[model samples]
Target: MALIITDECINCDVCEPECPNEAISQGEEIYIINPALCTECVGHYDVPQCVEVCPVDCISSDPNMVESKEQLQEKYHALMGKQ
Candidate 1:
């Protein structure tokens, strides 16, 4: 599943640079994760880098954008232009 940044985010600016897919961005009020570009760090890292560096623990899986591990891998491959 894609990750979601909750309102609890402190806007610490750490998560943005941690995202391997560059999915996290600064929103009007808080950081937002773009599900289209989010792969949960699959094909890159063992865990989501944003989640790992998030001090507030505001990052979590998005139920609405639920996806399996295979799907995330596919997305990662697509993003990297891999076969």
Candidate 2:
């Protein structure tokens, strides 16, 4: 599943650069994760970099945007232009 940044985010500006897929961005209030571009770092890293670097622990999997590991891998591949 794609990750979501909660309102608890402190806007520390750490999570943005940590995203391998460049899915995190500064929203009107807090950081936002683009679900379309998010793949939970499946094909890039063992863990989501944003979640790893988030000091406030505001990042979590989107229950509403639930997806399997295979689906995330496919999304990652597509984003990377892989076969």
Candidate 3:
């Protein structure tokens, strides 16, 4: 599943650069996670990079956008042109 940034975010800007897929960005308010580009760092790291660096622990799985590990791997490959 794609990770989401909650309203608890403090706009710390720490999670943006940590995303290997560049899925995290500054939204009108707090940072937002793009479900299309998000791979939960499956192909890059064991854990989601954004979740790793977020200062407030506002990042979590998007329950509404749930996906399996295989789906996320496919997304990662597709995003990297490996598929």
Candidate 4:
């Protein structure tokens, strides 16, 4: 599943750099994750790097954009132009 950054984000700036897909960015008042570009780090790591580094635990699975592991892998591959 893709991850979403909650309103609780402190704009700490750590999560932004941890996202392998460059999906995280600074929003008007907090950080945001682009579901279109997020693959939950399927091809890069076992876990979502942004979630791993978020201090307030503001990052979590995006319930609305849920996808299976194979789907995530397909996304990862597509992002890298492998599909």
**What TM-scores do the predictions have?**
0.98, 0.97, 0.97, 0.96
For candidate 4, give the lDDT.
0.91
lDDT of 1 at 41: 95
Question: Worst ten-residue run, lDDT, model 1?
Answer: 17-26
Candidate 1: residue 39 lDDT (0-100): 95
TM-score, cand. 1 vs. native: 0.98
- Candidate 4 regions with alpha-carbon error over 4 angstroms: none
Best model number under TM-score? 1
Q: What is the C-alpha lDDT profile of model 4 across 1-83, one tens digit per residue?
A: 88888889889999988888999888999989999999999999998998888889998998999899999999999999997
Compose the digit string of candidate 2's lDDT tens values, residues 10-80. Answer: 99999999888899999999999999999999998999999899999999999999999999999988999
On TM-score, the stronger of 1 and 2 is 1
Model 4 TM-score, 2 decimals: 0.96
Clashing pairs in 4: none
lDDT at 44, model 3: 98
Q: Listing every candidate in turn, what is its Cα RMSD in Å to the true structure after a full C-alpha superposition?
A: 0.4, 0.5, 0.6, 0.7
Which regions of candidate 3 are displaced past 4 Å? Answer: none
Which lDDT tens digits does candidate 3 get at residues 5-57? 99999999999999999998899998999999999999999999888888789
Better of 2 and 4 by TM-score: 2
List the global CA lDDT of all models.
Answer: 0.95, 0.94, 0.92, 0.91
Q: Give the residue spans of candidate 1 off by over 4 A.
A: none
State which candidate has the highest lDDT: 1
Error of 3 at 55 (Å): 1.1
